[model samples]
Target: MAVIVTGASGFIGGAIARALADRDETVYALSRTDPEIPGVNFQHWDITEAAPQAVQSLAAKATAVFHCAGISSVSADDDALYAVKVTGTRNVLDAFPKARIVHVSSTTVYSSAEPHAELWEEAGPKDPSEFTDAYSRTHALAEQLVSRIRPDAAILRPAAVYGPGETMFMPFLSKISKKGVLRLPGGGRQKLTLTHVDNVVRAALACLDVPSAAGPFNIGDPTPYRLKDAIVTHFGRMGYDQVVIEGVAKDKALVTAKLGLKVKGVFKRGDRAKLFLVQYLQSDRTYNLSRQQRVLGISTTQHLIPSRFQ
Candidate 1:
């Protein structure tokens, strides 16, 4: 298969690129940075910008595309987020009009509903006017644009994706583990829906082959893990010292998140802690994987804990 993978340098996108390359597929890695992987035809193209002549040329030759490029952080300003996530998606669709686009979306599109239930593929998107966070708002907008522009595009929404090459959440967890302290919101009892990087890649590949299976689908592990247990299990495998997981009040954690961002901005400059700490630590987000299984014919029950333990 000849494929074009946007954001091939990023964690999820890079994983997909590597997986496709492993299968000996002809891969066109399109992103602002080079994927630096063997057998990948790397092209420099920013999604927010117009489709460069080079990218347009590559897209013409590609059979399918994995659109995994977009802003994943809350640190980006509203303007930058909209430009990259919303406009960026529009540009990709325009550029790859012929390719079967597999869009990597997020579970954040769902609005804050009380008594958090399992989010399904059919759930409505968060109201635009109520958006306060740039990442969720822009991602939701980007999904809409994809559906509008190319309804056949397969949209895969994964939750708290973590694995090798995960620079955002994994590194944050590792850093806090090293400190021997994990200060979670609400005492870390919140159940988290985590999708392994491998499972997401698998789902994306399935989306490519599934005949006429287009639209939003949730991809996540079957087992829901708690914040504290997941952390302990993950860190233990990495040979980190025992981490003391403690939970602060949700209200206090919000205040801490606000203060943490401000203080980090003033002192640390570009810190990753300000990425999704507030929401991940505070909220309980899980998904109903029935649609994912029924549509993709792939279900992942892989635990985030180490191999030997499993």
Candidate 2:
């Protein structure tokens, strides 16, 4: 049976597509842009649009569908995010009615408005009103769509996913690191839930074999590494042992971000640095892994650092 993977050009999606192809699965790679992997059959279709006859035909033949395509930018506006994440997801479900869907979701759907000691997969849908970011809010809305349209669908909620093709943290760290010194906020003690791209793929493929209604599972590494420690360890492995990590108080970091954001036009989302500092660096977000470990039989602890480091 064939496997359909949307957003096959993206980091996580591309990895999943490659893994499936390696296992000799007939893979249909769907994306609006260019294909990232060579072996798979590439189909051009944006999920936000109505699926054309050709796309529908392809979806119909799939045994499983991995809905990995969506706008992930924290800087994106609500309307655009909604169009792709919510409406696009609806279109995928409509096109592939018979295929077992493994919706790639985010743990950011957990409400950040209130303090939670622990985040659980069973923590029901978050109210969109609670979140100010378009990515988080729209993802919550899209989850609602999956629950209503395909309750039996397996939804994998991964924390900050990082690996070889990671476009976020590594670049940010490299850019900010000055002569072996890296600056962090909150003493870099903020706990982070990071999932390797490989683990995410395993959890996703596992979902295909389970009962269709397996619901949502929180996918994250078993070890909750402090932001600074994780990055420093990674740097050391990369032969950058001289890296000296420094941290600033969370409140001071917020002030710096606020000042940096002031001169910039608010519309363009500022720069990556501003976004990272304001939205991510100063916080702690960790999720419960018991359900995923027990249900999926896949512990994400296999690779905490990227493969290059290993």
Candidate 3:
């Protein structure tokens, strides 16, 4: 059976589509731009502008759709982010009513203040009033939209995703490690959850056969880590133990305030680096993946951050 993957040009979307293709499943990859993946049918269609014909054409030949397309960066405007994450999802659902959808979401939709607490499937608070960033807010709204369309749609809320081809944090880690000065936000005690690209792809593949695997499921390595440990491990792997870990909460705030003041005229303070850091530094987000394990049959694996410290 063939599966349609949106945002196949992106990291997570590309990984999931490649995983399916590796299993000999015909993958119809839909994106605004074509990704250079072998053995997959590549199609160009913008979800924001309502690609009904494009979606329908692919849905006609596919048994399932993996809706992995959405805005993830906090640097974009709220309206543009919502259009892609919320409106784009609506268009896809409208075009493919019968196709099973695996809606890719983020664990940030959950309250980050108390991450290690209780993350119950049928329990805990659902709405996130504390989410300050446009990315998380719109993603949460998109999840609501997907649920309204298909309550049985499989929802995978992965934690901070990392692996080869990751452009966001891995590079940052490398830069800081090479400098021998890893300045952590806050006290570096914030518990963070991360999902390997391989594990996330595996979970997406498992969702294909498990019709009962509907609703939101947290997919990540069961082993949560402190932000400090993650950085230390990354540097140590590169054979560098002479690292200085500093926590300058006041300095961070001052720098953020200066940047916010400078960029206030050009961009709203909502998208400022300070605001983004507040969410990252102050919040501790984690997930209980028992539901995912029970439903998707995913076994927990070791942390993906390279273990050998220098």
Better of 2 and 3 by lDDT: 2
Candidate order by decreasing TM-score: 1, 2, 3
| Number of the candidate with higher TM-score, 1 or 2 | 1
How would you order the candidates by lDDT, starting with the best? 1, 2, 3
> Alpha carbon lDDT of residue 296, candidate 2?
79
How close to the true structure is residue 108 of candidate 1, measured as C-alpha lDDT?
Answer: 76
**CA lDDT, every prediction?**
0.80, 0.78, 0.75
Best by TM-score: 1
Pick by lDDT: which candidate is best? 1
Off by over 4 Å in 1: 113-115, 176-178, 239-241, 259-276, 305-309
Minimum summed lDDT over a 10-residue window in model 1 is located at 270-279
**Residues 129-188 of candidate 1: C-alpha lDDT, one tens digit per residue:** 666677887888888888888998899999888876676565666665436777777877
Kindly list the per-residue Cα lDDT of model 2 for residues 86-123, writing each as its tens digit.
Answer: 99999999999988889999887887644333588877
